[model samples]
Target chain A: MSLDNEQVQHIALLARLRLADDELGETVEKLSRIVDFVDQLAAAPTDDVVPMAHPLNAVQRLRPDAVTEPDDRDHLQQNAAAVSDGLYLVPKVIE
Target chain B: MKGQWEVVIGLEIHTQLATVSKIFSGAATAYGAAPNTQACLVDLGYPGTLPVLNREVVRMAAMFGLAVNATIAPRSVFARKNYFYPDLPKGYQISQYELPIVAGGELFIAGDDGAQKRIGITRAHLEEDAGKSIHEGFDRQSGIDLNRAGTPLLEIVSEPDLRSAREAVAYMRKIHSIVRYLGISDGNMQEGSFRCDANVSVRPRGQEKLGTRAELKNLNSFRFVERAINFEIERQIDVLEDGGEVVQETRLYDADRDETRSMRSKEEANDYRYFPDPDLLPVEIDAAWVEELRSALPELPDAKRERFVAQYELKPDDAEILTASRALADYYEAAVSAGSGAPQAVGNWVIGDLTGALNRDGLDIAESKVAAEQLAGLVDRIADNTISGKIAKEVFDAMWAGEGSADEIIAARGLKQITDTSAIEAIVDKVIAANPGQVAEYQAGKDKLIGFFVGQVMKETQGKANPGVVNQMLKAKLAG
Candidate 1:
């Protein structure tokens, strides 16, 4: 897969990142190189191998189904950019 | 118009698991908690914090798999679905991508013609829920409540097997009943414990290729799902008939307007670049553990219904009604097990009178004022000739009003049947003497006047005369 300028801008918007007009060309070029480097695995003859999702094949460790956390809303909301009535406020999202 | 086009639908249902804590954290999962109060560092995606799986979520997923006879994957992977939204503190959601916990099951639903149809379940995967974004209160901002963040959800995806909106609703209802029976989820649509998204497409009759589909999001009720699908089907048909192609997009069902509106088009659709989550490991279930869970499973709806039919000698429709909910089935069984009345009578009272009363009072079987034993007592009275069925109904009314037991009501109101032969004989004689004209008319050829004589005798006895005794005495006296 190749990353073009238009696709890079679209991804930036989806990620809520604002890129400068002058930086788009360089960013697109760098992203395309990264994609090309990852695409090198396509040349490998591995049709018989199973796809791996994790580096270590260990199973997940499960915690008991119980409530162990306390109410720390007043403290957690302190890190938000804005808050009101125990809610984290952001610029309006229409949908 | 009926045979013009074909509608194809698939559903994605998201059921919130009934766990005390969040899926990957120890934070509380109680609904209606204050905003952000239940969110911990792991839920909020703090630096260096990692997610630990909750054991109950896997058990619930396995229970659902067993209920649907789905293939329970021995090993399942978690992937991060990348997206940017204010409600999601993490930039991505941990979900299953390549391998899900459940795969390739079938749900049996009643088709439009009342015949059983099997809908193929493509997959059910485990995922964490996003927080709520409240957009109504703020003037130019939205508020995010993270109490629901990291709550475990099983997203069940179905194949494009539904041919109409009715079938889709039936399929959704079958899933709803199964989850409720398993006691894994509350299945409360109003509180959003259960919600569904529908993918709908319409094609010309006998077309092999499916048309471009539109997805309807967050249909919380069964009625809305049906209505939304029907509207979408009509809209697609209209578009195609007008020489236009159907566009693929996500639409929102505006319940107030009773129509769906475009929420996002294909151009703005998020890529959701999915990758396996590094912090979490794959989930693996041993065969022994799966067997243990399967053996410990509760009797599901279908088996219970069959048992009711065979054991209680109930009609299939009556069995279906009784087994609609576990509480109702248990209630019926308890009443029968009280061992005071016939099973069929118990079945009728439970299905007919008791259910009617409960519905009128807007109560569930669990919330009923009439206990199973109390209902058994009422049915016993009718069986043993202590009170007639008519009087039993009166007793039921009194019992519903908290008046007391069947015996107490019958005794307190002098409502017991007049089983004494002489007492009934005297009333019969009084009716024969008082209604001499009707008696002569009855003996002369008007045999239907026997009903009038019976009514007169009943009126004299204040409806307490045993009807059979009254009829026998009235016939003997009239013949003489």
Candidate 2:
């Protein structure tokens, strides 16, 4: 499948990315190439092969369900751009 | 409503697992923590962070699968569902996609007609919760609380087997009780421990193909789910009747307005590019572990209900109510075992008086002030004729008020039954003498006046007179 400029713009909007007027052409080219490269694998005849999820084919490691982390709001919130009442503040989000 | 259209409903219930920590992080999962206080570095999705699966979450998911008799996949994989929201700092949620932990189970719920209907469960998968975006607490800005982020959740999806809003609620309630009985969730709808999204659609009668479905999101209560489904069903039917196509979208249930409105159209749907998370591995459960967990499972509600009917000779309805909650079932058994030899009597008190009082006080059986032994004592007093059933209720009220034991309350208030023949005879004589006109009417074959004399004797003895003795003495006196 080929990606069009409109499709690329829609993807950008979904990703919450702001692109300059000049950046759109280059972005569409790069994303189309990536899509084409991935689409190439559709031609590989491997109907009987089992799909692999992980490279190492390893199962999940389990952790005990105990509260091992302590309350560190004061320290952790230091990374936030803005925080009030212990909550990270962002621009108003409509429903 | 019945013959014009048919409603097709499916439910996706998100049950927060009763885990101490988040699914992927070691952050505390306790509710009511200060904003962001329980969130840790791992939960914040800091760079170079990895998610480790919580074994308890997997165990809980497996437990639910077993509870519903679903197939537990020996191996399950976690995937990242990519999306963008301020509350989701990771820009994606860690959830199961292609391979979920549980698959293909059925829950039997009572239909509107009281017959059992089986609802198929499509899958139940483990996932990490998203944070809360507080849209109202700030001016021109929203607050993001990560406290709920990364919390363990088991999202159980059901096939569209429900036919009406009532059936959907029944199915939700059945799931709710099962999770609570498994001790896998607190099932607190108020706290969002158990929440569900309802997918609703409508079809013309005799139509085999399903109509377009509108998903109602985040209905946290049973009543809301039912009402939302009903409203959605009616809206769809109306739209179709007016030659309009029902649009597939996500809707929100405005419980205050008792209506559902479109939140987002299908055109605006997010394309969640789901892919296997390379950070986490596929979970593999050995048969030995499954067997061990199965053996440790408690007696489920159905089996307990059957046993109650078979062993205690309780009515099926009574047994159903008693076994609705594991704690109540255990309380009933304890009361019976605590020397309340009359099983039926004990079941009655537990189901009738005890449950009534508990509900009136907005308390659970575990939080009930009346202990099992105390209830047993009350039941035993009635069985042994120490106190009439009516007086036992008064004693029960006293016990609930923390007055004392059944014996203590009876002794303190002199509420014991006037089982002594002479004592009852004296009250009977006083009642007969006080109501001469009624007595004369009774002697003239006004047999219905026997009730009036019995009431007089009961009132004189403070409802402690042995009713049988009072009747016998009154009949003998009036007959002479």
Candidate 3:
């Protein structure tokens, strides 16, 4: 499938990415190629096989309900640019 | 004003599961912790962290599925709901999409005509809750508390079967009661453990097609759910009558203003881009495990109500009220066991007096000042004819005041009933002799004077005479 500039811009907007006019054409072309490559697998002839979520056949492991983690907020928030009273701060989002 | 129109409502209730830890991490799930003290690396969506399934959450979902008669999937998948928000550190939420753990069930609520109404449950799925974002006292920024993030939530979706606000409240309340009864969630709306979103719309009464709906968000209480839906219904009708088309959107319920306004920020964010989460494999719950949870299930409300009717021989209304909560039902049964084996009498004290005192004092059954055995003692005294029912009220009030046991109070107050035949007869003779004019009127066929004689006997005995025995002896003395 071929790509259009408008669709690419919409996807970028949804992903919170700002693409300049010069970057839009190349991004559209690359995304179109990725979509086409993924679309090729739709032609496979395995009619009875169930769709799988992962490559491995192992099932998800369950953990017993227990609290083992200690207070690590101070250490975890060290990488953030801003924090107050142990809360991570960000630009205000409207309700 | 909407006699020609019909309202349709469906609800999505998100109940936080009561777990000791987060859904996929070992972080504590306790509420009201400091902003980030309880958050772990996994909850923050840190690098190289993989989400694991919690055994209790899966069991909780299965118990709910069985309780509602839903189909528990043999295998369920988790999908990533992609969105951009600060509260969601990963920019996506782990939720069940195509194949949820529970699907296709119905819960019965009392309809408008006082009959059982089955509201269809579309599906219930497991999801991770988002963090809390505090906008107040922040300079051009919002403070994000990640403690609530990754906490387990069961989002129950219902079909658009509700017809009115009252019915909606009843349906939501039924779900709340079931979750609490199952011991899965605390169902505390004030603490944000249970909340609902309502999809409301209206159309002509005979129209089969549903009108465009506006989703009302953040209805944290039963009253808010009702008021939000009502306001949205009226707003839609007004729009349609004014030749305006209803726009499908998300609206915030302004509880203070009693109105709903379109949330402009969420207007264009409907594309969730859902896909299977690669970090987690499919969760497979076999039949044996499902059966184990089923066998371990507690007695639900419907079964308890039925047993109350058959075992206790209680009226349906009384049974319903007594079984409204597990604690009340347990209290009633314990009282009956400790009392004179009179189920109906014990049930009456529980449903009438105990419930009234609890409400008047702003307390719950669990917080009642009177204990079950103490109440039983009072009922036993009344049954053994040691104290009249009238005097038992005073005893009960004294009990509520923490005076002492029923026996002690009765003895200290000198309020024992005069059940002895000769004792009651002597009081009756004294009353008859003292009120000769009224006795003549009574013997002259003014039969209503019997109440006067009974009153005099009670007054002379200090309201301690058995009214039944007093009536019999007074009638015999007045006749001959």
Rank by TM-score (best first): 2, 3, 1
Model 3's DockQ?
0.82
> How accurate locally is residue B208 in candidate 3, as Cα lDDT from 0 to 100?
98
Model with the higher DockQ, candidate 1 or 3: 3
Q: What DockQ score does model 2 reach against the true complex? A: 0.78
Every candidate's chain B TM-score: 0.90, 0.96, 0.91
Q: Which model, 2 or 3, shows the larger TM-score?
A: 2
After superposition, candidate 3 runs with Cα above 4 Å error:
B420-462, B469-480
Off by over 4 Å in 1: A52-56, B238-244, B264-266, B425-462, B467-480
Which pairs of residues collide in candidate 1?
Answer: none
| C-alpha positional error of residue B447 in candidate 2 after TM-score superposition, expressed in Å | 4.1
Give the candidate number with the greatest lDDT. Answer: 3
TM-score of 1: 0.91
- Every model's Cα RMSD, please? 2.9, 2.0, 2.6
True contacts kept of each: 0.89, 0.91, 0.94
